[model samples]
Target: MSESYDVSYPGVRVWCRDESGSSSLVVWRSQWTPEVIRIETPTIYNRTVWTVGQARVLRDVLDAAVRCAGGGSW
Candidate 1:
């Protein structure tokens, strides 16, 4: 589903998950300065699976995004 940059969704986590040779990652709260610390994944994602923490963050971010887009957060 993500061989390249997915324009379908505009989020950093998703983007980071799909980037190539991206053995490590850092989820920024905002696109601002060097203020946020990054969380390292157990393994690099090749569009295959998600680590427990990664999956959790993904679900939460997607849910919030969906709600903010006007759909209910439930």
Candidate 2:
């Protein structure tokens, strides 16, 4: 199972997720147009764009990964 939450941000819909154990984050340009989602992983400093509806379904994989290597939260 996974847990997800929406974090408030101006002009954007930010989500955090933790799946099974691994974590990652997803951000949408806005709630009006959620077709595109940006996937970000802080651990490796990687970002990618996905357009599938599944992206929204998987938004619950963003968590812990947002934390810095030194145990700092982002």
Candidate 3:
């Protein structure tokens, strides 16, 4: 099987990647952009997840899907 991440805009749609390897987002997609993000701050027991910015462009588009799905709000 294969996987995909379909990124898009109001009047535009783009597929950024097709095939790839897997690793922590910190390695590749680092430092965060306007996109919704999962920040795992190191803790004694586990990691804390969070969102960094409030971008109106794709506010509820990409990463927001996780938060809206009750996957820990930022």
Candidate 4:
């Protein structure tokens, strides 16, 4: 089985997917950051942020839910 979900709010977007026993989430945001690089004129630049480690952490949480709940560690 497989499932996917998407959530968007203002300048943020989150995508989650689960297939078989693997799950992950990808988060993206549009905002001004130091990582932005000028693409057009020197005064014009684009800002984008993509997070993957956060998604992996969330997936790990699910794998360790039992331990977090005071159950035996896996």
- Residue clash pairs of candidate 1: none
> What value does the lDDT take at residue 14 in candidate 3?
23
Candidate 3 overall lDDT versus native: 0.36
Q: Say which candidate scores most in lDDT.
A: 2
Query: Lowest-lDDT window of 10 residues in candidate 3?
Result: 21-30
Q: By lDDT, is 1 or 2 better?
A: 2
Q: Lowest summed-lDDT stretch of 10 residues in model 4? A: 35-44
Q: Which prediction has more favorable lDDT, 3 or 4?
A: 4
Superposed by TM-score, candidate 3 places the C-alpha of residue 18 at a distance from the truth, in angstroms, of 6.2
Tens digit per residue, CA lDDT, model 1, 1-74? 32442212222352243344544343333234233323444354423334446657876997798878998623
Which RMSD does model 2 reach against the true structure?
Answer: 10.2
How are the candidates ranked when ordered by lDDT, highest leading? 2, 1, 4, 3
Model 4 misplaced stretches (Cα beyond 4 Å): 8-50, 66-74
What is the TM-score of each predicted model, taking all chains together?
A: 0.34, 0.32, 0.22, 0.26
38 Cα displacement, candidate 2 (Å):
0.6
Tell me the deviation in Å of residue 70 in model 2.
29
lDDT of 2 by residue, 1-74 (tens): 43455522332434445454555454544565566656555445657667767665554343434343344333
Estimate every model's Cα lDDT from 0 to 1: 0.45, 0.50, 0.36, 0.39
**Clashes per candidate (backbone, < 3 Å):** 0, 5, 0, 0
Model 4 reaches what TM-score against the true structure? 0.26
> Tens digits of per-residue lDDT for model 4 on 1-74?
32453333232233334444443333333244423221111112323233556545655886698567886532
**Number of the predicted model whose TM-score against the real structure is largest:** 1
